[model samples]
Target: MTHIRNIYCIGLNYVKHAAEMGNRVPEEPLIFSKPTHSFVKTDGNPIELPADKGEIHFETEIVLYIDKKPDPEFKVEDVVGKIALGIDFTLREVQTKLKQNGQPWLRAKGFKNAAVVTDFWDYPGTDICRNTEFSLVKNNETVQQGKAENMIFDFHELIKECDENFGLDQGDLIFTGTPEGVGKTEDGDEFILIWDGKEKGRFVTNLK
Candidate 1:
């Protein structure tokens, strides 16, 4: 099964998303992980919602496919194998409650079909920052747009910080945090991730 061996995620990599979520932009990157098997690709099944987790939100993000084997001594530019667009599904209500109680949000963030990844491209390390643009279109209207220029930690810096905290392994995937326009997903919502002005792939969600 061509699946990720490990998964590392950057939380609030965008300042606007952090402000919208009532969090301060951190001095350092906040990290999380999902099960490698949670990656839902093109042939992957539609996203299924949990029955009781209120306000399921879709966080459209940039995904990095790690290239090399796990190496604590590796450089930032050598870490990413490829780059893609992905959606990080979150049980927003559950997350808020967990935050209130000072609890870890693994259950709220990591669930079956949690990581939805689109197609990937070999974005050269030198040129990723000057990206043309990427956007998420819901039901045929653009809902979220992201650019590498807007990222708080950017590409090389994010990879460097992530590798410092968690030694990235081969078959590892990194979910860069979403930008501002996150919201609830209704049944029949069609999400298309467009990369560099082209349609990469899409993920449709089902209501509970």
Candidate 2:
């Protein structure tokens, strides 16, 4: 397994997602972070989540894996060494409260095992990535679907934002935002992450 360093996430990158969340689409990429402890693999184990915590919503995203420090004139194709389908689990109630209080979203977004990723696969180039569609299936029903072309801030722009502000390093990950159709997750819900119409990962939920 590749050692993960930083886990950067983009919120409201998709226009429809922004609208569904009742927020206007931003002119720039909305970036956030999840602690390293939030990372988890899709191994055959149940993902334990907070049962008492208000509704937890699932946001499926296309995750990029940085293999090395990028050059000043790095090409988007050169920056992403691997790709995977991942989930940005959100505690909706906590997030709303934090937003209302104008607080950082770490408490609502950075819980343990909050970031779930599929097995890494080689980067399939810009054209393929733009054309590929990824989705999340909850209990055999497709809950969320997204394509790169639908992104407001494309991959190149996202990389630029991260590098300019946070400085990307090898082993850093970017969870490029989710699409519409996000909903509440219940205990025993089975989630299957599909990339390019193929199943890449699956896991069951155990809300405690």
Candidate 3:
């Protein structure tokens, strides 16, 4: 795997996800980030999470891998070389408190192994991708599903926002927000990421 330079994440990008979180659809992308230390691949080994942190929730999302710095007028096809399904694990109670205090989400969202992704596949261009549906199965149950078409800020828009605000670098990653149906996780929970109706990756949880 390429060494990750930075990890950027979008919030409230999905319409149903916004509603489920009791948040209004954002006019622009609500951006956040996780540290590189949080990165982990879904290699079948158990993923360790904080056990004492109250209620960690799973947010399944489509992750984009930037191959190089994008040009000013770059399209999604120009910079994104690969794609994968990932989970943006969150400490629910900690995140709630952080939000109430108007604080950054790093503490709640940037824990170790919090950013989990599958092995990437070559991006098949935006047309096919926009129509593709990806899903997450938790403990043998389909918990969340999403497609790029439902994003409030689509892939192009997201890349533009990142370039304009954060300046995209090679190996940077973006978690393009999650869909609705996010719920609490537990010890021994297993997560499977399915794309194009095939199991792409999976990992079991080990709360510590």
TM-score per candidate, chains pooled: 0.91, 0.98, 0.98
- Residue-level lDDT tens digits of model 1 in 1-208: 3457777888998889999988999888788888865677855456776656678888888888888754656654677767778889888888899999999888888888788887677756746544658889999889898887788887666677777777766678888788999998888788888877888887678767
Compose the digit string of candidate 3's lDDT tens values, residues 154-197: 99999989889989977999999998999999999989999989
In model 2, the runs with Cα more than 4 Å from the true position are none
Deviation of model 3 at 181, angstroms: 0.6
The per-residue C-alpha lDDT of model 3 at residue 20 equals 95
Ten-residue segment with the worst summed lDDT in candidate 2?
68-77
lDDT of 3 at 75: 81
CA lDDT of each candidate?
0.79, 0.93, 0.93
Scored by lDDT, model 2 comes in at 0.93
